[model samples]
Target: MAGGMFIFSAVDTQAKFLTDTLHPFQIVWFRQLGLVLGLVFMLSYHGASILRTAAPGLQVLRGAVAAGSATLFIFAVSYVPLADAVAVTFVAPFMVTLMGALILREPVGMRRWTAVIIGFLATLIIIRPGTGAIHPAAFLVILAAALFAVRQIVSRALAGSDNTMTTVAYTALVSVALLSVPLPFVWQWPTEGWQIALLISMALMAALAETLVIKALELAQAVVVAPLHYTILIWSTFYGWLIFGDLPDLWTWVGAAIITATGIYTLNRERLAARKPPQT
Candidate 1:
């Protein structure tokens, strides 16, 4: 979980820096490029065959969903407060609870169900429907989470069919290919040494963050890792404060706390379930 946040934080910092000029789609293209490079390097080191699976459609869907989520997240960051954006993305985990039950046929008890409800509520608090006009960017994030949740669910289903490396490789390849269409309109020369450096760094960090996140998932239960989604906001708050002198309003933190608490409780319950003795 900590590693996942670490990866996402690096990616967020990179995205925040580019939000001023680079269209989110272009930045995501760079990220996809970097991920492809990283995937190539990692596979070379691991000596894994790239096309180890046949789920091309599923792989492409995962990439499209992830790319779209990232584009929306960058949009949200540009308009909404950082913590609020982070809090909104936390909805992915809670949304997953529903997906797991419905699509994967996983059992979710009342306690877990209630936690999912609270997690969804945290998002409502952040958006606060009809409480003055809400930021349109928030809805982008909601859509992102919904798509991302589906992607994660797809990953869960694909796990039995493919190795993680193939999954990452194919997703990056598909995303980079898909994003290639919009490169011409928003393309701008990187005019400064620091700007070039920053883009490169962001790409690297984005890859690092994802690798770490995947590692976190391997080592920890998704339920436990789910709550750690809020920590990205903590990091975002700090980054926004340092970079833009921006502080999240009270409602952001309040909502984030509720989301985090519920996420942790759901994971803890899952952890306990995993610990129980097998039936005779």
Candidate 2:
């Protein structure tokens, strides 16, 4: 899963590259459109049965938030370094912790909450609020992470009711709808071979990366799966340096390490807390 996640950064980098040639809306649209095709094939085995009683509203809400989150994240990556844009996404794990306590009424012990706060502190390290090093575009990533957290919360609510396949399918349909709405304003033909290559690159990576993520989760515990979060920093850093000639500053690394540590600790703590002290 970690390895798969490392490849996922390619989607971010490629989307940012393509954003120079295509709108985030168009890039996102192609991504979801490709995913929708992949999802249809996966759902073929289930026939119409997969359409049973999952919470459609929550699913659609998640789709919209994910659409917006992805759109904003890509938009920010165009202005910020790839690694820096990705570092700000560390906010999602922390926000998910808070959302679980507030929205799901899940019991969170003091230690876990402290870890959450520390995680946010890490995000601040990257942004450096008082300094001008942070781009205003960074806020877009922050908001994206926040909405993504809410989407994850909604996922928890609907977990057993829908399989991962159903969620993936919903993502395809709804994100496509969400991303397509702005096509009229941003649509343009690819006039250059480089532009065509960029779109194809973005869509292909987005489809493969997301599909592999779903597969990765099936093979491991979500908590066990969480550490893959840090792999994004590693991959993003490479892409930032190699493709864009942008290297993250010290604060970005500091924040990423802190956030990665806190996120890991919190996941372990949550797993420990979920235990029910074995039935007598």
* Candidate 1 residue spans exceeding 4 A from truth: 43-48, 132-134, 273-280
Best by lDDT: 2
Instruction: Write the residue-wise lDDT of candidate 2 on 152-232 in tens digits.
Output: 566665665777777777877889987887898999888999877767776667777766665655555566776777788
TM-score of each: 0.88, 0.91
Each model's C-alpha lDDT? 0.77, 0.79
The residue pairs that clash in candidate 1, if any, are 7-209, 223-267
| Candidate 1 total steric clashes | 2
- Candidate 2: the clashing residue pairs are none
Locate the minimum summed-lDDT window of 10 residues in model 2: 213-222
C-alpha positional error of residue 75 in candidate 1 after TM-score superposition, expressed in Å: 1.7
Candidate 2 C-alpha error for residue 251, in Å: 1.6
Q: Candidate 1: worst 10 consecutive residues by lDDT?
A: 215-224
